[model samples]
Target: MYDIAVVGGGPAGLSAAVQARARNKSVLLVSGDVRDNPLYRTERVDNYLGFYNRSGRELLEAFRSHADAMGVQLREGRVLNILPVGDTFYLSIGSEVEQARAVVLATGVARGRKFPGEAEYLGRGVSYCATCDGMLYRNREVVVVGRAADAPHEANYLRELGCKVTYVSAQPPEGLRPDIPFVKGNRVEIQGGRNVEAVRVDRATIPCEGVFILRSSMAPDDLMTGLELENGYIRTGRDGATAIPGVFAAGDCTGVPLQVSKAVGEGQVAGHRAAEYCDAQQREEKTEDKERM
Candidate 1:
């Protein structure tokens, strides 16, 4: 298993991996290609400190180069699900699953604005990641929460694979010309406790077996069912610790003042702490072995 699997290729994730590796810990960066910091689309990053006039893309390229120089393995694939088992975490990436001791999510903010219990029943019923849970709801009633090419694309997929889908929108899903259950309503609420029973809409419960919460684009939280997140950000303490052990988060995903300097500072702290924790575990095991011998 990898020492750490940094789940997002953004500034925070990249910096964290480097920090961990600098301490002699092996690191693996599991990120999709487009996740290399969307700020790269912007014209300038003057407020980012040191880079007085750097383009987002240029800075990202430099960051990537640095990560590569340090021998961090980079894998390309959209993260579909992150399963935490004991001390290791498993990431589902399009027919493949990767395991790691820790994960740092920097997948950015999810802004689909399609609400209520959408957050509550994330794993119970509302799931943003289709790739992971799509199979579970085969030929069952499933509602996908999203718009743009991403949402409809997923909806079409479910439909193609024989899922009864309702495209509930924050806004109408774009470019999807599929024959499926497309419910045009907001305020997506998941009703039920340990198991999801139905999705509450404006006037009805759109009775379904499953609800795929696709809000906007993917966030670090959406991929990890048990990771507590709110408003498209991965909820973390000041120390960057998440509800999920061994998984740390930083930067905008942890919420705003999303400056480059802030991300770097948080990344440093998370890196040091995670490394220390992993190191301590190793030492404990070594001691235990000696005692047994």
Candidate 2:
């Protein structure tokens, strides 16, 4: 298990990992493909300290190189789910599950609006991670509304579980199984009673027992079910503390000025607090064990 798992690979995430590593803590920086980061689209960064109008990509490379030099373990995979179990956080990264004592969410921000009825039927018949909930729909039909590169892989997981999978998206999914029906649509909606019954993509309706909605980045509320969010951003303090213990958030995902310097500062604070929290928890556990003796 890692001392901490820092999600996302942007400036905020990179800073968090680097700081945690500096504390001599083993950190697993769980990030998806770098292309998914909105920062990749930025052509130039002029305001960040110590950098003179360098391109965003250049800055990202520097951040990555720094982390690498620190020997931080970087895992290039999307965090499908983060479940708090006892004193540790269990993260689902594709098919593999890893555990960490603390978690830092720096996943930038949620980019798109949720589909109609998606939130209302979240657990009933909708899910975000196929690996987490695919077995529940064994022998059933499911629709995967994918907005990420891994959508097809998720569909395949559902199919492997004896479920009929239909991929719904604006463009044909790459690496998708030929047997799985692909429906091209710009807009999609989930309609059902008690459970998901069908998905309507534009004018076409495809019946299904479940719907798996995958996005490049999940909304803060959806990322951690009970975590507090204010107007779509994770509500965090200057220390990056959230409502949940052992969990923290930083960067644009937290809200506003949306600047690289702001993200870096918040990440540093979060990394430091997370290290302290973990150290304190360990000390308490040791004390309790000693008392038992």
Candidate 3:
């Protein structure tokens, strides 16, 4: 188990990880594919303090390098959920689970709203992870909603698992298996009664038993229940502490101005606070053990 887990690989998250490591705490930095990060595509970033005129990719690489040099463990995957049990926060990363004493959320803004029946059937017949639920739909029909860059690869994995996969997205998918049929549509809706029956992709309604809605990041509230939000952004204090104890937030997820400098500064505060929290928890546990003896 790590002392702190920072979700996101952006400027804020990298900063948080670096700060936590500075406190001599073990840090785990979880993030999706680096290519999916909006900053990675930015051609020029003109405003981040000392680094003027550098491409976003260059800035991000520098941040990542600093974190790596500080001994922060990096994992590539989308965090599907965060469940707090007692003093530990259990993060479900795709099909795997990681445990941490404190969590720092830096997930950038989650684009788009939920589909018609997306939330209602979340666990019933809808899923966000292909690796986590692919075997359940083997030999059964399922619709793969390609929203993230890696969605097509995930859809391909499902097809290999014997699932009759149909790929749907706003634009045509690159690297999709030729045998897997692709549907072009942006306005999609999920339809079902007891379970998922079909996915309505604009004008077309394709019958399916399951639907996988893949996106770059899950909203802060969706990641963990009881995490408060203000005006669609995570509610946080100046120190980046959220309503949930031992859980802090920073960067675009907290609010806007949405600048790289803001993210990095907030991340530093969150990381430092999280490290302190973990130390306090360990101290309390030690005290309790002594009392028991």
The best candidate by lDDT is 3
- Deviation from native of the Cα of residue 271 in model 3, angstroms: 0.3
- The model with the greater lDDT, 1 or 3, is 3
**Model 2, span 192-269: residue lDDT tens:** 998889999999999998999988887777666789888888998889999999999999999998999999999999
Clash counts for the predictions, in order: 2, 0, 0
Weakest 10 consecutive residues of candidate 3 by summed lDDT: 32-41
Q: Give all TM-scores, in the order shown.
A: 0.70, 0.85, 0.98
Better of 1 and 3 by TM-score: 3
**Residues 237-268, model 3: lDDT tens digits:** 89999999999999999988989999999999
Number of the top-ranking candidate, with TM-score as the measure: 3
Name the regions of candidate 3 deviating beyond 4 angstroms: none
The TM-score obtained by model 2 is 0.85
lDDT for model 2, please: 0.88
Which is superior by lDDT, 1 or 2? 2
Candidate-wise lDDT, in order: 0.74, 0.88, 0.95
Model 1 scores what on Cα lDDT?
0.74
